[model samples]
Target: MIAIVTVLLAFPLGFFLHNRTSAYVVYVAIFGYSFTFQTLYLLRAWVGGDHSAFSADPEKLPLDYLAVTGAIYAVGFLLITLGHRLGAKRRNRSLAVDLESSK
Candidate 1:
C-alpha cells in the first residue's frame, strides 16, 4: 500500500523535473530510499516474529513487490533521461539558429 503510493508519486515527480539533471539526481535518490525501505519491510515481515501470521510459508512472501519497484525506477529514469536529451537538443538548435542569423 505505502510502497505502491511511493512508486506512483516518484514517477510523476521524476518526469516533471526531467528538464534539469539535478532533479533527476534527486529522483534517483528518493527512489533508492523508497526501495530500501520497502525491501526492509518485506524482510522484517518474513523473518521477524509472527512471520507465519503474515505469510503461511516463506515462499509465499511477495517478491513481486521488489520487481515492481525496479520496473518503476527503470521507467522513471528512462523518461527523465529522454526528457533531458530532448530539452538539450531543442536548446542547441535554437542557439544554432540564433548564431546563423547573426552571421
Candidate 2:
C-alpha cells in the first residue's frame, strides 16, 4: 500500500514540482520514509532483546521489506529524473524557437 502510494502519487508529484520547495520536501519524505521503515523492521527484533540491530544475523534480515523500500526509492528517483530530462528538452526547444522567431 505504501509502495503503491509512493509510486503512483508521491513520485510523479515530486517530478512535476521539482523546482518548487514542496518537491524537495516530498523527495526527502518519500526517500527517507522508505529507509526509515526498513530500519524499523531491522530493529524490531532488537526491541525484543534478541540482538542488536547492527549485529543481527544475516539470515534474519528483513529482505522483503528492504526490497520493497528499495524499489520504491528507485522508482521515485527514476520518475523524477525522467521528468526533469523531458521538461528540459521541451524548455530548450521552446527557447530556440522563440529566439528564431524574434530575429
Which is the leading candidate under lDDT? Answer: 2
- What lDDT does each candidate get? 0.61, 0.62
lDDT of 1: 0.61
lDDT of 1 by residue, 1-103 (tens): 3346444654455445535667577776777776677667766876766453245466675556557666776777676666666656655664433435553
Q: Write down the RMSD of candidate 2 (Cα, Å).
A: 6.7
lDDT of 2 at 56: 58
Pairs of residues at least 3 apart in sequence or in different chains that clash in candidate 1: none
Distance from true location, Cα of 103 in model 2, Å: 18
Structural similarity to truth (TM-score) of each candidate: 0.48, 0.50
Across 27-101, the per-residue lDDT of candidate 2 in tens digits comes to 767667766775677578666666643545556766665676678777766666666666556656644334365
